[model samples]
Target: MSRWLPWAVGLVAAVLALGPALGPGYVLRYDMVFVPDLSLPTVLRGADGFPRAIPSDAVVAALSWVLPGDAVQSAALAAVFVVGAAGAARLMPSPAAAVVAGAAYVWNPFVAERLLLGQWAMLLGYAGLPWVVGAARGPLAGVVRSLIPAAVGGFSSVVLTALTAGPVALWGRGGLRRGGLLAGALVVVSLPWLVPALTAGAAGATTDPAGVEAFAPRADTPLGTAGSLFLLGGVWNAHAVPAGYGDPVAVALRLALCLAAVAGWAWWLYRDRPGFGPGLTAAAVLGFGVALLGATEPGRGVLAWLIGLWPGFGPLRDGQLYVAPLALVQALGLGAAALWLSRPAGGTADGPGDGGAGAAGRGAGEPGSSAEPGPAGPGGRRAHGVGRIAGVAAAAGLAVLPVVALPGLLWGAQGALAPAEYPRDWLAAQAAVAADDRPGAVLVLPWSAYRGIDWSGGPAVVLDPATRLFDRRTVWNDDLVVGTPDGGTVVVRGEDGLAREAAAVLGPDPRTGLPESLDAAGLAALGVRYVAVSAPVDNRFWSDVDGFSVVVEGPEMTLLEVLAGPINTEEADISGLEVTCGLVTVGAIIWSVARSGSSLGFQRTGVERRPGARKEIP
Candidate 1:
């Protein structure tokens, strides 16, 4: 029962949080977009800039072949909560503590905001963090196996893993060797996107310095930016905050919970001296510092300078992402608090000064601690009974505290994340484009990267589905337009050179993504064979235009075929280098698993040191 409790809790949390989102169809919000029968070849071909969708989309496309795309989406989203809760829960010694940790880990503001932002891939890696920590002292195979979720999540996830687990691996039993192994594993798993990014030249990897200010973390609660971040809720996008999450009462309660959790962590660290404690503490501190960097002018300048120095440093622009490690620390700390609260009282045997024999006994040093309360003298038993009842009630309250403090995460984020089916016209447009063996790329019109579609019965902003709807390469506006709190917008320059050329030719209206007139000759010259107007727009510009033929026209989507002179129908293909790297990564993982003879899930909970070995915290 104890072993299965965490899994059960995780599943229940997922069900409660997701609600109608797990029913059917795709939950399209911000960056999260899913299309049926996604083309694997097209995903592998990728776009001009960083292959952000590479292996994640590629994996999704492959899975869509076997399962419905909606089902795949539901499973992926559900996995975030389930895996996260289970992993965090396993870190605790007792079932009650596990329940608290698991719930706290998955129900926090970080998870809520990221989920609302539709960054399910990043969440997938977030879910796997505890497993990575657990596997830090194990064999290389165990590390690789633990990183599967991160591999699927792509670059950001890999970076987060490095920030969170790098310290643990380096300071663990094998020291530098373990660190080297971790680095090797990260590189191998990152090949799909890493190879492309390296060979993409300077242009493909370029990032806008303007994005530094635009994506910086902001205060979401009455508590200032630092306080909000400490409570794990300072996401950059205001729209990503959960409904009713900023109520003053809720903020105060959450702040108190965070302070208590931090205190519990300190107590547990001093008492248990768990092997991972020092390293985890270092990681949490470093991550929190990074998160705070964006809240100040000097730190923002430094971050901007870093981005200017190298485009790879662009990830640092979103400082809220760095708070992920802090979230993990808080979850563990909450668990430790529950452990302390529920321990038998009235004697030193199960109290704070028991030489780490209470909750610490079941900590990382002893993974499978199952000690139960035993009877004492009659007077001691009476005291113990009262303490046990009170402790159990307190532990139960702690377990429910996260839910009470952040009530907005209940029931599909209060219906902000409901699923929506693709309109028939959109599906028809996809079919029309796929049926044709078009050699040229599909140009997504509106000349904007994101769309506020009403297909979901509500206005949900998402990256244009047309970008990945077809079975060929797509050219669309990649520029990000971020709205500031001061009622202004910041337009971050895009990285795709070809898209920039298209924008120049079209000269699209700044507000509306539509051009004054259609330029057929110019598009054909740029290797654009089909133009897909993904958003609802007036079709007056399409009329009497030579070299342009309307293929599919509807209120939602308009597909046009360009037949001006000779088209540069050259198509991009997955490079031999990319294919080789992908194969090598897969082969390496297989070899590592074969050599180890056991995977992460199958491995014992803790690493066994030599007999008579004195555990060192640092």
Candidate 2:
């Protein structure tokens, strides 16, 4: 019964955070980034064959077949909180501490901000870190248990999990065996994203200065930075910051709460003396330092240098991501503190103490001078009373920070999965595109790669909706360029820009139409059979365009047919390689899951370290 309580609390918090946005239509953020490319075949092929870590996308796509896409997203969102709490609890010394830690992790400002940003893929890694830590603590069986979740988490998340688990796996004698097993499992699980990334030479393109700056932590001071991260509010986008972001009162209260939690955890670490406490502390500091380093010019410069040297390092540009591990470590520390305060007057004989006869009793050491055993035996009400008071204080400290910092989180920022209806004409336009039996591509007018959407009310700039507006194959303009050694940026279009060169011939002015820019012959040469415009445009853009006829003229948009375009059906030799790699990735995960008997349980409860476990600090 105690085991279920923390999960119950976490579930309720997660539901409250996402309750309003659970709808039938795709949410603004989900549709903007994920919906456009939600097809299974597309995932198998890899997103533009550039290794953008589409495994999570592929899994979500596969799940959509069995469940409604909206339901799958809701479940995934809820799992972030549920798994986070469960894993955190496994590392904690007591149930009370676990409950508090779980709530603190799930309801904090960082989780709230990322949720609002609609970065589900990155969050998946955040959710999986605790389990990774548990599995890496030394046991071949544990590594086997960690594969399924790691695979489902996608590539970026797997990397985050590795950061947390690697330190633990590398400590003590014979650590190499356990660590090697863990690393091999991670590699196998990450193949879906890793394989494509290696094959497609565009991995370096992902780490742009713009992306680095976009998610960097923005705080006034070091203390402020730590406080904001503790409350989960380090996102660089000003508009996306938590409610009451820069208010003096809110800021002060948040810092106070963070200080209290950290101080409380430190006190608990001193008293409780859990074996992993020191390592967790180090991991927290390292993660915090890395995140802070990425927020400044020097950090970005360093990252830029790394990206130039190795394309795989490109994903690390978003320094804010480092905050997840720090946040996890903090949550666990807070839990340990709460549990310490609630212990009996003499402390539990089986509780985790700093090498004392408590939770770490297997190799317990002397108690601190102030922590000497009391005359009162276990279950004494007097000590319990004092402990209850301390427990309340710790929980209060952990909860207040997020509550005050992100008050509007529960009521705002949710995007509907499925609404009752879309603009009727928009639906008709999509139907027309899907109806076309031909294999030609589409050209979306106001042809750029990104724009503010109607659903999100222009709060953030997202990928162009035109890409997802049609069921037929489509093409859009390139938004990023890769840097070459010669100081020139090269535009590499993997798969999407089928008609880019031809579309380039059409001058930027859409209103000028075919006469001055492109004629019917040019349209045919580009292999573009259709064009759709969602935003308002002058009638002249379509009126004078030759070899095109109005197919569906709706109040919100216009759909045109390119009556004389030639469709190209050439296949790439590399297509077979992509499919084969995807298959092997899918098969490996399935085989591992079967071999492990589907037991992905994180059983790291209690304080018994594996025999021969090294005492060396990570």
Candidate 3:
């Protein structure tokens, strides 16, 4: 009945350690806020303001449904991970081994944030992993075998989670094979949500423009590469590695101790008969090294790298900075060492009397049984070594967890500093165009406001009662825009240095030696609507142009709707298809999942997904 003592102790310790995040710090320190933008009720988009991005929206939506309170839902996620880490910790042979691995895990910035924020699906994945590793150990008596699956099936996001537990279902042997098959069936059950994400161009297809561009890789490759591997953790957000982890002083010391611990344990394992599977040990070491180096890419990653070549390895782009294979390696290395140490030197049976996982206590079998322990000769040495590693890790954690995780508790995770606000006055000026125009009208706004365009929400924002314009795309001198007969819009950008270029745009084409200026008659000829000028450029733009009535002029921006009326005569020669380049990635994901990969398939996309538009109340 009590064969699972180590696991239970580990679980309790994990819980007690991390419970602090669920309180005041989580809200102030995370993106998960109680402020409701109400974007979850419908689809969310950027400029089109019509069809919504369902994948990211759906997860938030689900949370809205399950737990009515946002804070509760958020804390619940942290709790889930606490349980997951605990369960995984519990699976280790000794509480000390669990402590070392758990310390490495909790100290990781990404891991802590994921647990603290409502990364519900990821926490589930984390929960399932312990079971997967434990079940791989064959059989354990006293504990209910049925509990094995709870660990494996833990992290299935409706879309990507399938990839996580999918591999085992294919060709695994014994319990893992059976459970993998069962998990595969369960993933199949979730196909309704997963299949459409593949076809629709959301899941693997996404390549967020806003994320990766902020960190220019082409500009600095090596630092970027190392940083991508070190910090950021995922491909999309993979940028500069932080000063932690490999902290010149901290990591150097940690590595020295880890090396020393490994040396002691290796000697212990090689002493007597020289048993233990070489393949298992090799896999652990290799996995640990790669994981320690961390994930270089975010999403699915570059097509053919050695680690990525492995099936399911594609999605496992993040969290490798310090967790992933490191956990498994530590597990195997420590487990083997523990087992080896518990062996009595002279070969005398210690039975359940020795202070090891002693012969199946309680309902567990007696001396010669399957789950029983051997003699306790030098078992104390390995236990002591494992304990030393934990002490080192704990010491390192004490150093970092305070300096890093403490103040992070004060603010949300997005920008460490407050970003300058967008010029809402220009947006408000643009907003006025809707009031003057007819219902469901298309209003062409300046390209600058495109970032927050979709916040208008629902049926209203798509075709507002304003002139329809491609604010994010079409701009002054844009070929199709200037060539079109739609004039009920505005063009806003920095007019200071751009005057000459602006003059050239509204004037003629020097390249072809042709004149393209639309006169007052040309304004009607080119669907002249509005040209909202931001700030005071030169008076020349107003003087040169024939008819520009100032409908409303604010402190910083000016509204310039053309008096020439609507010119629907000609359509702009716009080219290119409206493709969500990020969504196009589904093809590659489909190909990879169907085909074979090189190593163990990667497991997670640790970066946060885009947030839904938060529409301001009228």
TM-score of each: 0.93, 0.81, 0.44
Q: Compared with the true structure, what per-residue lDDT tens digits does model 1 show for residues 455-550?
A: 874677889888888998888999999999899999888888889889988999977998998899999999999999987877687885788998
In model 2, the runs with Cα more than 4 Å from the true position are 30-37, 46-49, 144-150, 200-216, 220-232, 264-279, 346-401, 414-421, 455-460, 469-473, 478-503, 506-527, 571-577, 601-618
RMSD, one per candidate, in order = 3.6, 5.9, 15.3
In terms of lDDT, the poorest run of 10 residues in model 1 is 348-357
Tens digit of per-residue lDDT, candidate 3, span 500-605: 2333445644342223323444444444455654443344545566665666565545566566655433322111222333233233334333442321122211
For model 3, what is the alpha-carbon lDDT of residue 298?
38
Clashing pairs in 1: none
Which parts of model 3 have CA positions greater than 4 angstroms off? 1-21, 24-68, 99-101, 109-124, 135-183, 189-192, 198-243, 257-323, 331-359, 362-366, 369-618
Residue 28 Cα positional deviation in candidate 1, in Å, after optimal superposition: 0.6
lDDT of 2: 0.60
lDDT of each: 0.83, 0.60, 0.34
